[model samples]
Target chain A: MTAKQNTQNSLPQTIFRRKLPKLLLSLFRSVFLLGVGFVMLYPVLFMTSESFKTVSDTFDPTVIWIPSSFQLYNFKMAFDLMNYGQALINTVTILIPSVILQVASCLFISYGFARFKVRGINFFFGLLIFSIIVPVQSYMIPLYVNLQSMHLLNTSWQFYLQALLGTGIRSGLYIFILRQFFKNLPKELEEAAYIDGCNPFFTFLYVTMPNVKPAILTITVFSVVWYYNDYVLSGMLLNDHFPLSVTLTGVSTALNNQLQNMAGQTLGADIKLLSDAILAAACLIVVLPLISLYLVVQRYFTEGVERTGIVG
Target chain B: MAASTEQKTKNKPKRLRSLEKQQRSWGWLFLSPWLVGITLFFVLPMFQSVLYSFSKILITDNGFELESVGFKNYLYFFTESTTFGPYLTETIWQIIPSVLMILAFSTVIALVLKSNFFGRSLARAVFFFPVIIASGVVITILKDQVMMSGSSVSDMSPSYLFQAPDLVNTFSQLGIPDQLLSSITTILNQIFDLTWKSGVQILLLLAAVNNIPGSFYEVADMEGATAWEKFWKITFPTISPTMLVVITYTIIDSFTDYGNLIMQMLQDYYRNNNYAYSATIGVIYFVCILLVIGLVNLICRKFIFYASE
Candidate 1:
């Protein structure tokens, strides 16, 4: 396949001159993409494989790619060990409230910046950007002190407020994103609403909000993913009371301890089967929703981000 | 013209009469929640942290009193010589390669994903999922699994690429000099090896690519420009602002590693009641961040294209 005649060439010159190279190009591209795709999927695949394997099989290098026998007990064990039910509830409890507050806060803040010429507006904007740039560590000392003083330790509200408010601007990414979205809205839409005698609040909700549905959804999905997968803030605030990721850590450690007892023995079939089932069940419960959501919003997420001027 | 100006004034007064006072008052309504949250959580703590940097934590019978120590704490870090300098340097060195690799890899992957291809969206999601999942604990678990023991994150293995020995062996088999091959391998490894933890950058890059106007590319195509030319002219400028942002983000994000400033402060603050040291480090880190973000802003102002403008 000469370079000149390679059908894989996407250049304009070859478009009219050759067809074979295009076919070859597409073939090469698919293969390359599939290879990279597999690499990207490696972690999830490994986790899935580990979830189905018996306790003994998990560490065995040779048996990794395929399980000798499907054991479903691992999922059950993981579930019980992690207190999956409580953690799931706790996760939803924290995620829903936090995301709601964050959405509201972002809207109000960004709307003010976008819609009005408030005094010291530039100062406020600079403060917001500065807040984003300043690492969370900068305020951790004081925030921890303040939270302790407020006696909000181990409380769900602590997580909610920290995540929800402008306080823990750690999610400056979200704030920045919302600000950009608000700025891009046409003033004409709001002006038309004003002409019809709609107040600012009603106008924002009825006009601007409807138009930025895609941005809202994108932010909602991002907040969900961030909050659901969140362990750090949960760890910092919740102090290990059944946050989902915290529960996973707890269960993994417990399982590590249990592994020591079963070492060097081909596990008796019953125990192995039980452990495998438990692990599988836990992985399914934890990962299924996230993967499904990922698939659903995957396109919107990319498209929304691109419109926000994220990539050049 | 005079009659129209009188009509405009009359119409404007009616429009303004109902809304002027309400508008001035209601601007706070739109901004109040954020303003209150910031005042309570952001404004107070930030200034307090700055003040706390100059004071020593006293563990007297009075629980957690602060004794004003002037610039002693800051001096200890800046001039009196603590382990801070070496740790700062080590952390900075770790941040540089990690951030650079993330930028390069994300740029390449974003470019590839942006091209018309089957399963492009899936590829983007796979790459972006890591950003959402790669929190502190997740990174800790990943590090435990992948990183060699005793080498902190400073010792990065190029991600999704061959390790040094394999690359060296391949080059040697091809009759290349060991020294020459080694340097080339080193550079390539630095450039190509991304630490496999760049999900955030990938997402940001994908966003940047999506933001590039199709009209710019269409015009370039009409002008008979090459693909390379189109990228350099249209794609690069439009996305340069984001690159600055993401790069600054990656740099600052790197500093938030578990062993660095944030985690260190958390541990020391809780365990030893050392607010002064923590505050000092926090200020230093904040200043470093401000400097980096300032640089990024300066760079961005030069190249950020505003289509509306």
Candidate 2:
């Protein structure tokens, strides 16, 4: 009986040790992931591909699979209508300053929270997070009233300056991320700086900031993406002064008009094709920079999230 | 010689203490920009909102005019306003279902992705990319193609697909009944409402899962506990802090999104100088949110096992 039981247990162990099941399981998981991934990525691909399709081919569901011909003229027309050059300049104008200010202010505040043992720091920090929790929409009316009172309404500077003051959506997430990183850093390095007669500010500048470079890069990329794509607030702040995102809306409005006038135009197919090209061109112009930034910093951003130990 | 040198050096710092004080003063001085920004911008303005919530303001050729109203705004919200009750109810109604779904879906996704598998990283990237791209502007730009103006997305397509009919038709032909189809559609619609919106919660859940110690799982195996038991005992407790974070994040995210039509109504009210009605509605919605958060916290406290320090 003992021999038989030993053999029975050993038989299953031998089968479990085989590599086939694990490999099959992994293959199954991969296929499932790929299917889901395609589903997720389809919309993006559809929008991009249709941009290259001709106007008459656009509504033809059969042609949706791929563009028959890559007509680049649609892009030219779209660019002209949207004033892409001017909008790109305006976008950069806001993007650069807003990014710099957001990173700088968040760095200081996060450093303060992480390094100092000041009284009531926790309370104040909690309040800051509370501000983040409240819907920004809730503050819109009040913000408008205050800005109107400041006589800063309807100016480009209104968006730029409000963002620069660490009050933008970028700062909240950036500050939280940076603080988590700062908290995790070994205190020995700053202590060594102190031993070498360096003060807290200098130590932070030379030692801490350099160490948190990944987090800083993450913040920079995040700010560019968030502030650049913002339309609702940007819409309210800059009346008729269109950024790239806003210009996309303006172009959409124009496309609808072209669509409406299709019946009268002799060159209806060409016009539709032109509209398709413009839409694709516009999407490409706005999305390409951010996507590239994402691809470059993708590894660092993921690594930084884990390193900061800020899963939440 | 060592003792004498140490003592002398310690005394040296005290001798130059006045200079040290001046140097230290620069810390606060360095902080002056933040101080000015917070006081004038954040602190002062926030207080002004609270004040404005109670009082009515009238614009003039001169600076603005203010009329003191005590409890009138609060009373209107609780009592007589037509939209205030329904608006508060609708906002809360949307928030609860949205948050619950976010928690359930994100938790499952995080749990599945936590396993070591092929293409896991890519899967995560795909999941996260929507959040990166789908801001208000991107959505607004896509609105013409994705949704029709003056249509409650549900009414336009099927209330379930954000008006994306192609996907719905595919699902329907899978031999699903109309009622079952409708329910599935509603769920899909809700999922669409919450997916990109819950990025913060997903990150939190991932953090919680990562924090669970491997030793606990090893011990559970030694005791002959099943995989399910290990999950129940070890994984669940470890991630409770993250659960709180996700809950709080989801509730606020769903509530404050500018896409909500009711919020737009509130905005219109304020723009039209209907301050009293807007404040009443705002305060009601604010209270409802607080109550929901409080309930979640109370319930979770029972199960959130904190490791003994």
Candidate 3:
């Protein structure tokens, strides 16, 4: 009896020892990631659900997560009140030119830093990184005043000037990323191009630039998204024709005044009551385009990140 | 040693010297646009800002005039301002927990995402969701809702969802310690704040983890090392450089975040047309950032491991 019991117990005990911790760890990872993912997801879900709520549903505490009735009223109000179309056009104009110039200039500059070790290059590189860490707010006064003097404020020229020079919105960081990628590349390829009677410029254009196409795409996507979301500099410069971001920022306060004197409606009470829901709808309209863009390009996004020298 | 180096340089071959000269010119040619940008937009502005910080300026017809104020703007911020000291300390305090939590969460999430699992692509995209909402209108609205505190709207927003862990009320019934409860509340407060900022950090870390050579993991597997043990021995050391990068990125993000008090104050002063004081504030704020980053690098230098070159 003792021998039989020992054999049975040892078999199960060994299986348990081998499997339990591994199983637990896998379970823990899934649960932990899902929990955090849910939190990351909650705002989107909350806003969507809230945007669909009737004016009365907001007042009722029972109406959480899911609303009593689905309504397009908030969205209609948001679209008309926010002047969505004009703001989007303004955003696109600056965004396209900025992203194009930002990518092109940064590409050239980073390649130079990576390929050529000129006199004072290290000092320049240090300054580049220093600029990255320094808050733009510190330098904004002088830059802003100078730009104003140039009559660049409230014009697309301001955006173009910064981008053309490779100083547009976090361009320092972009230069750094591209430089890292360039440094890790094999020296033989550029040398071979040179040996084949290609000058350094042609070598960069043909041999080197093609090699970093994925990185260029990465920079382009980042530039687009950052330009789309930018508020600070754009707000400062484009005071007359506001972008989507600047418009959205002051939407709440603007809504309060606008709805009060709105055409043919006494939404004074209802607007106050439904302000949060309307804001939610407006947020979605602004955010949805970028979300769709992400869904389309995230594969290249991750792939590009993998190829960069952001790693050990 | 210096004389020997000078002799060696003097005796260098003609072809190599010509190549060096060619490279010097080419490098400058490639970097010309950026060099101009730095000189005009960066270095010049920086110098002017320093000068502005030291004096009073009156806007006029001919590009304004500066009058020497003898550190009055600097003195006000340093000695007289009541909020300055607290704001400075709070900014530094904010970085510690925010950076640690961001680093910890991003590392764990990136690890989990790296593994093959059900709906792994979806999970990866979901992890990057915050990066989409990081800077713009949506985050501002969300942050505003939280800042509104105690309103019904605030309670219903995502902050409430994040604050679902009302363990204080639940545990109070069982008579748990008050101090632990407050700490728990503090962590719950930071959850929404820290977690959203982890998106870019996660992206960088995932790349770092991917760049780790497969052979190390395979060797660890063959040796029967558990996942946790393998992570510490193989993964952590390998990813230390990226960890430093992530930490620096996180600290910088926090310092420049929309909610930062110093930033708010600086903007406030700028908006109020107090240019000199604002410039002074900007300079001081920049110094604080420099000191913090310098400190972080010094600390990281001791422990940051680099794979054999």
Candidate 4:
């Protein structure tokens, strides 16, 4: 009987020991991830919920997470006050041309750096890396003055010039990414193309460019998002015609003024409340396109980031 | 016919040399845009900024006039300025802890996200959401709203989750010094902000973790390695390069962040028509960033493992 008891106890102990730690670890992971996910997502949820809160509901302490009444009017007010349509158009006009110019120029520059043994290439590449380290703010004052003298300020030509010259917003990072991608490509394709009587340019166009599509797509998306999100450059350069980002900055004051005119009573404290709601709504609108784009191309986005080896 | 073919073969080397020269010229042709950009935008502007920093810029009828101040602005900034000292120190203090927290948080979160779990993709999307929406305008608005609501409802709010004064008090009671307590609370209070800024870092770290060869883990497992042992031996070394990159990226990102006290000060100066002084401050800040980056690179390089190609 004692021997039987010992066998039974040992069997149960082995079974429990084999499965318990794995189960506990998975449970711990889930709980930890859930907690972090909540933290990461709470702000967005707050923004969305706050955007739907009416001016009165915004200040009510009990009204948390869910609005007492769905205030769809906040979106309309924000849209009109921020001039969403015009700002969106202005942003796109600047963004599309600049994105194209930046991507094309950076691709050419990176390909040259990657494939060629040009003299002083290392020196130039070192300077390129240094430029990446130097924040735009460091040179903004001088750039502003330079642009003003060139009559380039307050015009889309400023962006076009920078993009054409491979110095647009975050262009250094893009070039770095592309160069790394190109350097890693196998030499066999270019060799084959050359043997087939293809010139270097044609070989790059046919054999090399197609292979780096994911990187190209990556740069395109990143450039577009960065340009779209840029407020400092747009604010400094284009004073009269505002992009979506710049417009969003002053949307609060604009909404405040609009609310006062409509309500006609001194909305001194209430203005803050109303404007906060409108600001939330406007913030959502500005970021809507980017979020949707990320969702659609999530796979490519992750893959592109992986390929660039920026982390590595 | 044999002699003619030999002559053709003899010409091939010369032809190839010319082709190489042509390729070199084409390379420069392709790189011309960048070259021009560097000269016009980067190099010229940087020199002009330095000159502006050392001069008193005056707006003239025709154009701006620069009267050389012989380092007066720099002198004033270093010795006489009341605002610069506080702003600089505050920014430095903020950067150090925030960078550390972001690195640790991102690495841990990346590891967790890398594991095979249900709803992993959704969790990743949730984590990456901030990279999409945490724009300057959005963050400013969010902060204001949180502060406004936080003052009213001290508890039972998400903003309160970040406000851990009680935790700080408890730590203080446990013999933690006042200075350390305040710093701890400051970090705690800005936990949300730090987490928001960590979106890209997390993505980068996650990619780095995923790139680690599974064979390393399999071998470790076959040798009866503990999870902790495997992490240190296999995961850490493989991802050290990425850690350096993330750390550098984080430092730069944090320094140049738009929503910061120093940026606000610079903006104030710019708005107040202190162009020369603003340039001086900007240059100084840039130098500080360079020093910090150099320091980090120096320290991290010692531990960085480069797999031999």
Native contacts conserved, per model: 0.41, 0.16, 0.52, 0.45
Model 1, residue B116: C-alpha shift (Å): 3.1
Highest-DockQ candidate: 3
Docking class of 1: acceptable
Q: Which regions of candidate 4 deviate over 4 angstroms?
A: A1-11, A111-122, A177-218, A266-269, A303-312, B1-30, B145-158, B169-177, B213-226, B305-309
TM-score of model 4 vs. true structure: 0.86
Cα lDDT listed for each candidate? 0.66, 0.66, 0.80, 0.80
On residues A1-312, what C-alpha lDDT tens digit does candidate 3 reach at each position?
A: 999999999987987997887788789878887888988887788678878887778667787778888779989988887799998899889999889999999999998998887899999987887777777777787888788888887899888888888788989888887776676566777888877889888899988888776668767877888899998888877776788888888888887777667724755466655777788888888888889999999887877655543233
lDDT of 1: 0.66
**CA shift of A210, model 4, Å:** 5.6
Residues A8-89, candidate 4, lDDT per residue (tens digit)?
8998797789788778988998898888778777767777887898866766888877889766887998898878899999
Docking class of 4: acceptable
**Candidate 1: residue A179 lDDT (0-100):** 62
**Colliding residue pairs in candidate 3:** none
Question: Which candidate leads the pack in TM-score?
Answer: 3
Local accuracy of candidate 2 as per-residue lDDT tens digits, B1-115? 9999999999997877754454455445444455565555566656666666788778789856768797777776667667666766777776777788889878876776678
Residue range B7-123, candidate 3, lDDT tens digits:
888778766778778877889888999988878788888889889899998989877899999888889987999998899898889789878888998998888888877778778
Report the number of clashing residue pairs per model. 34, 3, 0, 0
